[model samples]
Target: MNEPMDMEAVLERLKEKGLRLTPQRVEVITLLYQLSHPTAEQVYSLMSKKFPYVSQTTVYSTLKMLKDLGLVNELTYGDRSSHFELTQEEHAHFNCKSCGEIYDVDVKDAHQLQYMLHAEQGYQVDFVRLEFYGTCPACAAGGKSEADAGRTKQ
Candidate 1:
């Protein structure tokens, strides 16, 4: 994977997409670029620290706008909070049950999967989300707290 993108490049891309470049929008984009997949509350909290005037509602709305413009993707694994990430690459996610960490898994057979879905189900799939839940190596080695066990499926 390439290095995390800079804010100027992100801002330029947003402008190309016809989005207005406001301070609130820039802050939200910066947080998303830096943190990868973060929940709205997480973005709001970080923005609040640096920008006391930035509101949660503004962040939420900005995220929605970015998503609509195909600049960002949203993921929800039935978790309490929705996660947002930049849509620069396509990959699946592995959610560790014990550590509560989300790892990006490269999809070597994405085209095959898409072909099978289209051939077998006759569904024109525009987007796909594949999540694998399991105990990561550290958690399996008893590194995580006991309370974290069995929280997700493998």
Candidate 2:
């Protein structure tokens, strides 16, 4: 897989788009690029550790701005909070029902799927999101699902 984009280039792109390079923006960008998939609250929590003065509202606004700029993608997993990630690459995601973790998986047949859809239905698609829901190997082996563990403790 290709390496994720460096934060420097991202910041430069943001600046090129007339957005100020504020410290809060930097923190949010770093979190979105570093953390696999984080929600606004998670980004704010991490930013608070580094910049205690940062607020959740700031993080939300920054994330919204980034999304508007097409620099990030907002993903929804069931009823959980929305997760944000850099839009540097096109890939599929595997949602682990057991642990609620999202793992990236290669979409080896994306092009084929697109072709099939167009040829079959005479449609043109811009982008596709293919997500699989199942238990990850770790959870299937010996790991207890989060809900199961919580219930046992109760």
Candidate 2 structure quality by residue, lDDT tens digits, 1-154 = 4445777878888989998999889979977766767778778877899998988889999999988988889997668679887876777888778876677788788778989999999999888888888987868896756544212111
Cα lDDT tens digits for candidate 1, 1-154: 4333566776888889887898889888877876746778888888899889888899999999888877788887664667888775667887887666666777788768988999999999887777889987878888776444222223
Q: Please state the error at residue 70 of candidate 2 in Å.
A: 1.2
Q: Please report the TM-score between candidate 1 and the true structure.
A: 0.79
The parts of candidate 2 lying over 4 Å away from their true place are 143-154
Clashing pairs in 1: none
Flag regions of model 1 displaced more than 4 Å.
1-7, 141-154
Best by lDDT: 2
Of candidate 2, the 10-residue stretch with the lowest lDDT total is 145-154
- lDDT values of the candidates? 0.76, 0.78
How many times do residue backbones clash in model 2? 0
